[model samples]
Target chain A: MGALHEGHLSLIRMAAAENHRVVVSVYVNPTQFGVHEDLDSYPKTWETDCGMLKDLDKELAEDGNNLGGIAAVFAPTTDTMYPSGRPDQAVNAKGSFVTITPVGEVLEGASRPTFFRGVATVCMKLFNIVMPEKVYFGQKDVQQTVVIKKMVKDFCMNTEVVVGDTQRAPDGLALSSRNVYLGTRRRKVATVLSKILRVAEMSYLREHRLRDELLGPAEQLTKLLLMEQHQLPPEERVNFEIDYISLADPETMQELDEVDETRGAIISGAVKMLPVEVPQPGEDLGLSDGPPVRLIDNIILKPVKL
Target chain B: MGALHEGHLSLIRMAAAENHRVVVSVYVNPTQFGVHEDLDSYPKTWETDCGMLKDLDKELAEDGNNLGGIAAVFAPTTDTMYPSGRPDQAVNAKGSFVTITPVGEVLEGASRPTFFRGVATVCMKLFNIVMPEKVYFGQKDVQQTVVIKKMVKDFCMNTEVVVGDTQRAPDGLALSSRNVYLGTRRRKVATVLSKILRVAEMSYLREHRLRDELLGPAEQLTKLLLMEQHQLPPEERVNFEIDYISLADPETMQELDEVDETRGAIISGAVKMLPVEVPQPGEDLGLSDGPPVRLIDNIILKPVKL
Candidate 1:
């Protein structure tokens, strides 16, 4: 609720403009997280969320916008969201990965096995309860948005899915709710991710080959992004496990062994931060329990043909 | 299509009475039966089924009855019904079993685990294809009617299910297509199944405990109905394979251990006729595969409170 950022605003504004009644559900569903994942620390600011909506409503109202069309904001309790959501019907079971059938078993399915199922189930529940005609998501969560669109089509749902542009900071860092967790210095270097991707996109326009031409620069940029942004050294790259970084077919989301010009390619990546040890003398490895290493961040690059 | 009977006529009549455009689907869905169950030898009376409908239409027309409502008859090919009905997506994998769901796993779930699934799935495909507002069924398949009703409610289906009373012969043999395989003498003894249930109904009305008091008289009546009325011996009663005989809650179709005055009961049963012994000298005991022994019948009884 507190992050009254432009990226979130864009989604709300688009929904308001396009749909008959716009519903902004500000819930960070806990079911999509793994047991060690950050469910408790996820940023939520109801007052700020409400304030942003009120400001938008005032602006729209002054501009002769029908404020009634922008329906009530939905902030559901965790009880309502996760009730009977567990697979075994057990109460307060640890978090599960959200998985979607067929699609969830391939590509992203490989990394977050239960991810898409949790997502599809929760979305279906929300859709059934809300009965929304149109739902909005920012392009920042590109893979999630795509997964949802595919789910709606396959299940024959009536809702229209609208994906807004990924809003970026002035330095070109992708806007995120978790971006608030970055320190002041770490925040500036985070922009390198988008900047390096832009360079890669421009280089791909001039070349067609992957093996000898684009692979070296792409690999270098990937390493540079992790090192420069996360402040992790080359030795730490081994611990900062890169799950997969590859070019794939954009439509079916199937990883391409060889690049084809006819079909578009998506360059996506994911990594888990290795568990860090606190420097203490004879500290029992099991005694001091630090937070578990978490999986985060994904990027997508579409090839440009000049 | 030779077994032209009144049971089939009742379905047609109910369909004509209910809808502006009635489509009577007469296909014997192959997926509903188990491998050992009757599939090949079952009667296929297309000519007679059509003739009976036409004759009923004419008779109703002459009698100034409302019978002009019959619009079409849908007798689809077997391939269309089972194209994707099985659990194995590989064999008839056109996306069969689309209709049935977890709801089919309840009452009929035990005896025919896949039966209700096949029924519901085929019915859904038929319903979608025909776009019918109303569908008809005979009361003889009471469990099937109940299963379908539950499926429709669970799936939020729009079609109305109308059940016609079971049509029976003068001696009380419930009409069925499989009855065609019975010889003249066996067909006479078949009526004993219904007559025994009729006495059971009388016993229930006399405030007799079914299992404790009524089973003796019911079994005796069954033997008497077989011997005196149809000229069969007492040993023939034991030869008839009885599947299940129980009173159940009419709504949920759950078996009630003890009958209550407020709730009604359904007395249902199935029997396998004795196989003929064909002589095989010095080889093995030969059981001649006399006609299909898969005979089923049921009678519903309401409680008479003092």
Candidate 2:
């Protein structure tokens, strides 16, 4: 539950088309975020979100059929969603939480271990409270969608889950609220992230074999982005800190070594926090007033298995 | 499922009346009965049962009303209900079965500890398959009703449970399939069971103090019947044996120490197999031919607050 974005709005459109009612719940669930994660700074544009819904409602209803079917937008507080105190206590009492170490142990899960658990718990609460016939989630958070699907199946939840494709910027960069934190020069460099992902997607879909064939092109793209597109000097090029890069089974979300029966690969990563020099050892880096940020991007590619 | 006795008929009738469609399941649920128990000989009256339902359907139709009523009778085979294997295996798996020990531990539970678990598992399967708006159970098994209620709450089942009161003979012996096993003389002796329960009810309503005020009478009545009521002389009074006489809380189904909260009492018991000969070394007990039938009886005393 985050602020309204085109990615989330696309999910709402999908929900409205199929279901009798569309209920959008906008709550920045505190349980899903780590103690150091952006729990406080998570964008929460409620008034603007409501305004967007009003505009969408009018637009959908403009076609004389009166499809104005937005039911309720729930923005619950932290206590209201996770009443048993924290996520751990909630999972302990319910014994019905989502976990797929078998699937999540690779890629995105490598960096954020508790990410899927947080997503699963909050989704379960929403499923129970809303009791929606169908719920929609954005594929922008591809790993989240996979985790939620497994949880729903394991728990025998009655709701049908629909995942809409990720909405991207004109430059192919995936839309994220964190993208707002980018400055003029950093924003120009961020375009390379999507550009690298596009290259990986094309190579994997073509006649690329598993390890040597796929890794060669992927490695070349990363090198090209750092050297040419970003125009980083040799010293600055060394500063590019990549979180994780890997091929994974699109369906199960499990990492692949040789791509056996691999339907697709979700190539994803985050640019690490930039280093800052300080006067004292204990002194804060304090780069900007806006706070530190990490830019993330992913491309879902169907592998051509030979 | 054991060949539709009057006990089962009462449940079917309640379902037909309340639900849009009533599915009278007739297959005997083998998983519920424990080993060494009379699972094999637990009655098989399906033909008669079906005829009874046909008559019931005719009666309902003759009234010129068929608003989604008595849709079908689902007598699924044992394999259909317990695809996993049997009741014992099913219950042990993840402890999914209803824990009726809280009530059973006190009264009838001591005699037939696993009885309620079997009942709950079979009932849950029935609820899941039928997905009925409402399911009906007999009050003859009062503790079973309580256990099922708790299970419904614990599992968050959507179906509503309706319990019909205990139906009895003019002499007050609780109607049961096992009653058929009672011989001419044994039949007369069976009336003592009901008479004792009624006495417990009277004593409870009359403000009887001590905890055993109710149990003492039932025990005394059983002893007197074996010694005097039957043709047996005082020395031959070993014909009937009392398994256990217990008083329990109606809500939690746990045994109570004293009759303080006496919102009522579920006075229940089982009659052990009688020895064939008195003062003889292992005579061939008539229990083999007639089988040492286990008969259970319960009476809910009016609330008697201490």
Q: How does each model score on lDDT?
A: 0.59, 0.63
Chain B TM-score (model 1 vs. true structure): 0.79
In terms of TM-score, which candidate is strongest? 1
Clashing pairs in 2: B103-B253, B104-B109
Query: In model 2, where do residues sit more than 4 Å from their true spots?
Result: A1-11, A24-68, A73-132, A135-306, B14-21, B27-45, B59-69, B77-90, B94-133, B150-159, B169-171, B177-196, B219-246, B257-265, B269-295, B303-306
> In candidate 2, what are the lDDT values of residues A104-221, reduced to their tens digit?
4556656666566566656766775676778887777777777777555534466787888889888777787776655333455566656666666666667564755665676787
RMSD of 2: 8.7
Residue-pair clashes per candidate:
22, 2
Candidate with maximal lDDT: 2
Every candidate's fraction of true contacts kept comes to 0.00, 0.00
Query: What C-alpha lDDT, on a 0 to 100 scale, does residue B49 get in candidate 1?
Result: 78
* Model 1 lDDT per residue over A81-161, tens place: 654233332223322212233445565656655555556656755764576878777776566777788655534456788
